[model samples]
Target: MSEVKNRIAVLRAEHKISQQALADAISVSRKTISTIETGRFTPSVTIALKLAIFFNVTVEEIFSLN
Candidate 1:
């Protein structure tokens, strides 16, 4: 852990997209998205990669170990 926090869910909401939509785009289950956003689970590298791609951001941008 010890990573900088992200504003991912807030940003997603700002974009007005549902979790299911995001999950579809990222190729993950909606539960995964919910878990990540809620800090209940940390995603694996592959899942992180998918999320980065779906968000159109670099992994560093999406996840910071600051």
Candidate 2:
């Protein structure tokens, strides 16, 4: 099986936003963003879509299997 990975941190940095800021924008918790960023938790499809929309990118651009 492929391992899932994401570019959330990179995107956040590029946008000059913190985890809490992202979470607030997406209506999630800061801890949720942290866990996802650290690979300790994988976000649900809803959250993934929210992030993509917030960053003006496709979901595939943010996440992939490696």
TM-score of every prediction relative to native: 0.78, 0.95
Q: Model 2: how large is the Cα RMSD against the reference? A: 0.7
The ten-residue window of minimal lDDT in model 1 covers 1-10
Candidate 1 displacement at residue 33 in angstroms? 0.4
Give the alpha-carbon lDDT of every model: 0.79, 0.95
Candidate 1 clashes between residue pairs 3 or more apart in a chain or in different chains:
none
Model 1 CA deviation exceeding 4 Å by range: 1-4
- Whole-model lDDT, model 1: 0.79
Count the clashes in each prediction: 0, 0
TM-score, model 1 to reference: 0.78
lDDT tens digits, residue span 12-66, model 2:
9999999999999999999999999888898999999999999999999999988
